[model samples]
Target: MKFTYKIDEKTELKMLDLQESEQLFYLTIGSKETLREWLPFIDFTQKVTDTQNFIQSTMKQYSENNGFQAGIWYEGKMAGVIGFHKIDWNNKSTSIGYWLSNDYVGLGLMTKSVKAFIDYAIKDINLNRVEIRAAIGNKKSRAIPERLGFTEEGCVREAEWLYDHYVDHVVYGMLAKDWLNKNKIKRV
Candidate 1:
């Protein structure tokens, strides 16, 4: 597996490591309020150990060949994370989930990172389908897939329990033939 993905000169994604727990935890705390609204795992992550546990789980996921979680680094700082929930090899499909630090909202970082992921999924892994689901209220999050030309498939009612309330999600999908990043280089 690739250790790092250079999104650009200023943006990069690294496979999450155990040593990054502190930095990851701090980044999570810094954006907890904003993240917690849409992500159910935020409230459960209260300390560095919690972040470490998450990393361990991702490590297991990697070892099992299910998928991976990558830390988003911007200009040498932890900015966020993007990852696959799992790969359904039988169907050649996978679902992606991501979160960005509140500080780095409008830099077009997420849109770029997501595009790279789609390219990797479709071109590198030869996955036939990619899906991204975002809370209906989160316009910014939902925009990534749309900006990348993903088709808005449908909505699932109360798809996720965010702390105390269930939020609806809009599902966006792209097929390998529909992905337009034909010129991207796939890491071997």
Candidate 2:
């Protein structure tokens, strides 16, 4: 489970040095100012340093489990985060999630990033499928998959609680073949 690779900046937006989509920004690490900007969008009250430490620690875990966790760069700084979690190499599946700094909302960077990541995962990593789940009512979060052509699998009622509230979850997924077919059409 050695997850080590130099992701090309052009091929992987997560690795890009300049991340901007009109009004949004992206970065891997944030400065003190960035911390203040993103603090509210963050679901936890932990210090910025704590978040950084958690990123480092989780990266190690992802490496151990043979997966990837990439920082979503927005504007000229770190505006949000996204990653592939719980990779099952044997089954060639992974779960994806993301959060945006409040300032970067309404832009379509997540959709772009998700599509790019999916392409990377399926073609580069040779994964068979990728899944995305969001707690119901999070329309902004859930739209990423729908806009990218993922099929709605179903709903999981009260599957997990977030911010002290039990939330329903929606699952979306895409297979490698479907992804390839869609890309082929786009190239036509």
How would you encode candidate 1's per-residue C-alpha lDDT over 1-188 as one tens digit per residue?
A: 65578989999989999999999999999999988888889889998999999999999998988889999899999899999999999999999999999999899989988888888888787898999999999998998998888899999999988878889999999988667454444434
The C-alpha TM-scores of every prediction are 0.94, 0.74
- Candidate 2 lDDT score relative to the true structure: 0.64
Once superposed on the true structure, which residue ranges of model 1 sit more than 4 Å away at CA? Answer: 180-188
For each candidate in turn, give its C-alpha RMSD to the true structure in angstroms.
1.9, 6.5
Cα lDDT of model 2 by residue, 56-82, tens digit = 656676648656566555443445566
Q: Looking at candidate 2, what is the lDDT of residue 160?
A: 69
Report the alpha-carbon TM-score of model 2 versus the true structure.
0.74
